[model samples]
Target: MNTFHPQYLNDSQGNTISVVIPLAEYEQIVKQLDELEGIRLHVNTHTGKRPSIPLDEFVRQRMAFSKPIPPAHNGEPIGSPLL
Candidate 1:
């Protein structure tokens, strides 16, 4: 079993830092945080391990992005490519 006492502090900016968490609330929060961290790490690892796209593929993707998507969807430049 663990115990925690609620407390509060004010910094130099006079901002109030309230500490009203009960022990049960703190435990719940910590458990949720551990789960969240695991999820974040999993997502980051998956992203990091994604296969690298070749340079030619990258250039082709960029060129396709730069061209005005024909609005003939309605005829107008969808967006300015530069900047």
Candidate 2:
């Protein structure tokens, strides 16, 4: 049970236009939204009648079919080989 203290911003006519919350609260909200999105995706995928493969087999199949990424240059970070 999380509680937030939000401040309202108004326009020239004093009509509320937006709400502001603390930075930490904003970050928490974003994190919760990301988690909720992951949950929603998982639920949607599982609700289908399609057959599923073991995680290892799925990873293997994906890796076998995926094209290799070109190497990063000029000190750039390298992409994951498994991606």
Candidate 1 residue lDDT tens string, 1-79: 5456767777789898766777787998799899998888788788885446797887777787775566756666667
TM-scores of the models, in the order given: 0.39, 0.58
Candidate of highest TM-score = 2
Candidate 2: segments with Cα more than 4 A from true spot:
49-65, 68-83
Clashes of each: 1, 0
Instruction: List clashing residue pairs in candidate 2.
Output: none
Off by over 4 Å in 1: 1-17, 49-83
Measured over all alpha carbons after superposition, the RMSD of each candidate to the real structure, in angstroms, is 15.0, 11.5
